[model samples]
Target: MFTRIQAQVLGALGVVVVLGALTLFLVPASEPAPAPVAQPAPEVVDVPEEVPFVTHQVVGTSREGRTIEVYTYGTGTRDILLVGGIHGGYEWNSVLLAYEMMDYFEAHPTAIPADVTVHIVPVLNPDGLAQVVSGEGRFTPDAVRTDVPLGTGRFNAAGVDLNRNFGCKWQPESSWRGTRVSAGTAAFSEPEAAALREYVLAHMPESVVFWHSKAGAVFASECHEGVLPETKTLMQTYADAAGYKPILTFDAYPVTGDAEGWLASIGIPAITVEFHTHESMDWAENLAGVTALLARP
Candidate 1:
């Protein structure tokens, strides 16, 4: 009996009532916003400050193409070149001593005299050092091969005795304890020796010091011509400070193509500060010696 319009309105009202009832309970209310996640505290890392005196550089390459690093201290024009391990791992203690000196200069920048610049080549013969040391970079006393002979680690990969490869009175063969080691085909023939020669020529350092072992004396360098007058002063200076006997000549045997001698040949004062033993660095003595050298005018 109802009209079509009235029937349609009644149907729409019934659908709205059902939908409202479902929405009132079936839809869960939105949950409160997630509690802000606490971000982890940013990691705090401490970096070490660089020392003013420390400046590391690669001066040259070794026979096996290993980098020969130099640690230079100070910016003075009166440069002093200090070399260690020229005989390679056979005299590793010398290299250790050189490293100790570098560390000292870095920590105590004021310890180095204002007018002096110190250049330290800790290991000149890398291939030979590798033969005795197991790992790369810094090494300890235990890293050395104890059973190796005294002369075992003396030569480079090219079988050249670097100490005898300099240009001073050079020969094809040189005697080390009468053993007759190969000096090289010619003066500065080996890459290690050549690199050192080039560096010495370029820098023309005011003085040079080569550290060795088991000699128990400080020695002045002399070419075939004769010893430089300044060589005596350097030898005495180091010796007086370190309490070692200063000897003008290496009377143990005739040494040819010696590094110090080559320095003398070029008119640079050079000294061989040989430690008493192969095992010990003689740190205190050498340190005093170096400190004295740095304080020189």
Candidate 2:
């Protein structure tokens, strides 16, 4: 009943709808993304345990607040103290030697006798040591400066000679060779000396050894009370083993308020073991000496 033009329009519309359906059938729909997979938990790791029979402590602090450290090996009551770097950077080799001993003991814990304990003070004058070596607590040879003067870093930050700041025969001015150096305002005036004093009083070790340099000998200590009988025996034992000369006294110069002398005043047997030179540690010789001492009765 419709007109020809109306019928033609309806047929065209129907043809367009059929073409749309054919296109929908030809093109495929996109697949949904795969579901995310869960991950397994990460593995946990255990921290390494601390080394056995080896202990470290901060006995005191330097003038500039640097820690004065002590490393103790073994658990025996007969304590033997080995000190180095009392002169700071001037005797930096001593510090190196002390550290070497620590390394050795750490590696061979059984090397120390069951009845003996060894305490090592690596550097007593940390401020002076820092003036020459860059770092804190521990350092290596390369950390030291070669161009520094011989006596540049020998004194504490307060310009006092720490070796002369002890209590025995203390003077306002002390001599190192022919040159006069300040011994601090009073005995134990410097904090470094005070720290050492406190440590010694608190824990009186059976004997003490202070490593120094350029003398190539081991000298016995005395302050009014004369050298302790045991000190002479210790000097001889170390000297014989290390090939160093055992001297009764240090007369190259008059040293007042020396740490060894102060120790002698208090009846503690102590010796100053001077190395061959300021640069070399002479490890073999020192090791022999230390071994001999440890083996003693």
Candidate 3:
């Protein structure tokens, strides 16, 4: 019943609708968007455990309030005390040698025997050491002053010869190479000396080795009791191992109130292991000597 134009229009609309359906049928649908991917968590790392056997302590302080530290390695009952820098920067090599020993032990913890405990005091007179060296605790050879006088930085801040402040054959004044030096007001009057004395009394090490310089020898210690028989064995043991000359006494000059002598007076065996020079540590020789001593009966 519709007119020809109206029928044509309807036919065109229907054709347009048919074309749209054919296009939809020909096109394929896209895949759904991929689900979000989760990133892996960061890896966890474990911290290194501390070495329980190696330990350090601040036993006392120097005259200028500098800490006097002791580094202990091993956990045995028989203790061996190694001291250096008692003459401070005047014999700075001793301090260097002590630190070298500490470094060695730290690297080779098992180098210490099962029966022995090693205690090291790298700088007993930090003030005197500071007088010459620029840094605290550990220092290098470059830190030392080349123009330092022979006797510079030899005494503590109190101007007392710490070596002469001990009780054995103590006098108000002591001689060092014919030059008189103060022995402190009395036995262990200086705080540094007193601290060492207290440590010795408290721990009572089986033996002690005090490092010095320019003597090129191992001298045994003595007081009123002369030298302990074990001291002779120790001297020979260290001297033979290190190829250093062993002497029964330091007779070149008179030394009073000496720390080694004080040890002898109290029945402790002690020796002075003097390095060949003030600059070199002689590491191999001393290490062999220490090893031999540790292995001895």
Candidate 4:
């Protein structure tokens, strides 16, 4: 009863139904093979390691038995020693300035020259520092007791002017701000002075810089022999860079057994960088001067 085209269509539909039935019976769904058990991807993470800038060594101890830390920056052959707080609490800003310098190097290790090694002794007289500043590392200007006699905080716990206890034209006494100060029994008499002396003798640094305050000038170091020619150049260099006056001699007061003078006596160029005030570290000027010194060929 069907036409030719209709019969062909019906026969195709019948074959498709038979195939669908065979597929359903033969395939056997099998619960989709347990959904193939999805797995988690492996994770990857990256971490950076920390880099150290300087090496610290306990070269000596203070009079109060506190550690006098010497931080060494760079391993270059030519060495320079930068000392701060030799005057202790009287020049506490010097210690802060030295710490600032250390921090700069730690932050920008590349700023240091390849051929130079810089050693910094932040506090040479911890006892004297303790006299003025109560805290260990940092203290504000208000912490200083100006009520005390001017030079009372300048001397160490043993009552000796550390700057005047070095082995150069050393005397039993020295002068500070028109007041007579004890220079210890002899040269290198105090433990602090002895420690610095031993370290200097052992290392024989090419140049030495001592930070001081309230002079507003950069003074070249000299001994009985006279100023080292290199000292004159260095003085000019720092003074020019820092916008400070370059002084050939410190005639403000007669000093004996001075640390800088001792370095000069041993043929090393030495300088004392005096800040304009005691309250501030004068960080910018000193940092400029330090950069200029390091840039020297």
Question: For residues 70-173, could you state the per-residue lDDT of candidate 2 as single tens digits?
Answer: 89998888888999999999999999999999999999988899888899999999899999997776899999988888887889999899999999999999
TM-score versus the correct structure, for each prediction: 0.81, 0.81, 0.82, 0.79
Candidate 3 lDDT, tens digit per residue, 1-297? 999999999999999999999977776667554679988897797876754678998888888999888899987778999999999999999999999999999999889998888999998899999989987768999999878788789999999999999999999998999688999999999888888998889899989999999889999999998899989999999999998999998889899999999999999999999999988999998999999988886
| Candidate order by decreasing TM-score | 3, 2, 1, 4
Better of 3 and 4 by lDDT: 3
Model 4 RMSD in Å is 14.9
Clashes of each: 0, 0, 0, 0
lDDT of 4 at 91: 86
Off by over 4 Å in 1: 1-52
Candidates' lDDT values, in order? 0.88, 0.91, 0.91, 0.87
Estimate, for each residue in 128-169, the C-alpha lDDT of model 1 and write its tens digit. Answer: 888888788888898998777766678998888998999889
Worst 10 residues of 4 by lDDT: 44-53
In the range 53-146, model 4's lDDT, one tens digit per residue, is 5898888887788888899888677788999989888888898898889989888878889888889999898888888887776566777777
Please give the TM-score that candidate 3 achieves against the real structure.
Answer: 0.82
